[model samples]
Target: MNITRFFIQGNEACARGAIKAGCKFFAGYPITPSTEVAEDAAIILPKEGGTFIQMEDEISALGAVIGAAWAGVKGMTATSGPGFSLMQEHIGYAAMTETPLVIVDVQRGSPSTAQPTMASQSDMMQARWGSHGDYEIIALVPSSVQECFDFTVEAFNLAEKYRVPVIVLSDEIIGHMREKINIPDKVEIIARKMPEEGPETFLPYKAEPDGVSPMPPFGAGYKIHVTGLTHDERGYPDASNPETHTKLVKRLCNKILNHRGELTRVKELYTEDADIIVVSYGAPSRSAITAVKNAREKGIKAGHIKLEIVWPFPEEIIRSAAQQASDIIVAEMNLGQMVYEVERVVKSDAEVSLLPKIGGQIHRPEEFLEMIYKCQK
Candidate 1:
């Protein structure tokens, strides 16, 4: 097994990672800051004996992905805000159907074509609340190109394991920037678990003791009925029954929320004796890391939390950081989106401050350090 090194953009890296994770079907509609993901998949997937399709629109793109997932292949799609907005119905549908899939949202400026080519972390909140439901989501924010590849594979693994749609929430910079990444010859690939029960007596929606139902592939003769309607253990529509709706929805949420401890990941620096702890995700975390070091160099006890898992919010990590800091500074390329969650979790434990950047620009290390020092004061 030989390792291959490649200098490539983040979107391309993500496309390659999806293929590495055993994704056989990719359906996407091209959009700014995310089109390269579709482009690269178009080139790479067919060679791997997989299928790549450019759909009519974002809605159709995700519809195709959902179909492919049921057909027993790991499926994925990429888009920015506009396309992502269009995919919300299917996102909710995938959640309700318990379909294992991955979506790469390389976010640009939002609120309807705000900045097509610029970077922003404004979509951080949307990643959590985009779909109109109470289902839990797994969203990984990669600060660099290497993580773009790494977390794309991780997303697929999580999606298959939980049987939910996992999202890779990248920004414009990370998606477009070119960086060197080591491609492992044998990265771990996890396939969706199939039921051991025979087709003679199988109920597709029947979750195990672990609260996760195995997804048998279509044409596997399981006689399964998949739908967005409220379903029971038999996978048949049961929308009329309130108890069935409650049970199905609760299981859908509890399955991921119960596993939140393992699904969450964070990077920490100088957090033990910190007076100011900067919290960030996506590209802003890069500057947050640098600012923490710069503050430490200046004899300031500043720590940093690079939150890789943005959804399910990584509350425990923030609680840990808050235990050691006087000031919790939340920084992002937005006008305070994730700062609300940081404020909620670390309330009264640490003084929460916001270092917001808007209009598609990034905050420099020195700029964040300046804000950190001010908050320290």
Candidate 2:
């Protein structure tokens, strides 16, 4: 499909992507770095016969999204660091209940509200394991405004396709940056599969061969008992039998892990024959790519590994890169979120070092060059 070029801010592009993905419900509170997303939804959703609610808090915002998703509508919410922290519990709920929803986290700095208006990629690990519990989350990190638009739509599609909460993890830099994005006239969108059996035979948690249960909307004839606790195929709370618990947990994890081949996506730059690899994601990755190219000019064998899908870790690719590369430098906004994952996969085989920074500042290209020099030495 041909896409038309248009200059747009990352947040605005995300909203447009969600609208294109058939999102009909948005409930979120206003937060810096992410407020533009809510604002755009407020203005555009109504025009598309969609509903937008300015919730009182991030908790309520996520709650409303879950409710709307259960009602058979594509639902989403956008927030920054503090708000993202508040919504973790509900994120867990959405995972346990197999609820399909999209969360736009325009991340800012810190363990708290460190920087409201500034950017930070510190939320990379948080997006993966912020919520309490063992569950799989699909997170997409877009580097440019165009990907911000394209990935938001893809986020919604993955959410509905997997019946799990998907997060569009952006940072303040990308969220507010204005760039030209080619918005497609007509793009492919995926919707959830409704129950096929009669109400009497329907089991909300009953797994298919692929382990994904057919979703039934709230008002649908097939009544669903959604809860955060471990449940049986019938959707009723079932904590007694270890067999049931094992099956339920396995299904939840396998539904995503088994499909890793499809879920894991990434971008590689000049990886072939590169002795040193700079691993990064989100906006920081943009700088890493430049660093790799600049290092190459100076006779350094440096390449870049840019993560598009953060969750599931892309272990296969990381492992391959680790085995082939002499050194791996992880550059991220946080002190060591994704660095740990790289270490785990790469280990002593690859000399792994973290070029860490926080508090609204990103890792500079010069820092990456330093790492490349160290790797060469």
Residue 363 C-alpha lDDT in model 1: 87
TM-score of each: 0.98, 0.98
Query: How do the residues 1-377 of candidate 2 rate in per-residue lDDT, one tens digit apiece?
Result: 77788898999999999999999999999999999999999999999999999999999999999999888899999999899999999999999889999999998977787788888887887888898868898999999999999899999999988889999999999999999878988789886897788889888898888888779787776767888877888989887888988888888889999998998899998888888999888889888998999999998888899999988789999899988898998988878889999999887888998898787877788988987887788
Worst 10 residues of 2 by lDDT: 218-227
Question: How do the residues 1-377 of candidate 1 rate in per-residue lDDT, one tens digit apiece?
Answer: 88999999999999999999999999999899899999999999999999999889999999999999988899999999899899998999999998889999999997899999999887777778888987887899999999999999999999989898999999899999999999998789887888888998878888887789788888988868888999888888889999999999999999988888997898888887788888888898887887788888889988888899888889888987887788898988988899999988998998898999988888898899789768866
Candidate 1 all-Cα RMSD:
1.0
lDDT of candidate 1 vs native? 0.90
lDDT of each: 0.90, 0.90
Clashes of each: 0, 0
Local lDDT at 330 for model 2: 90
The pairs that clash in candidate 2 are: none
Candidate 2 lDDT score at position 27: 99
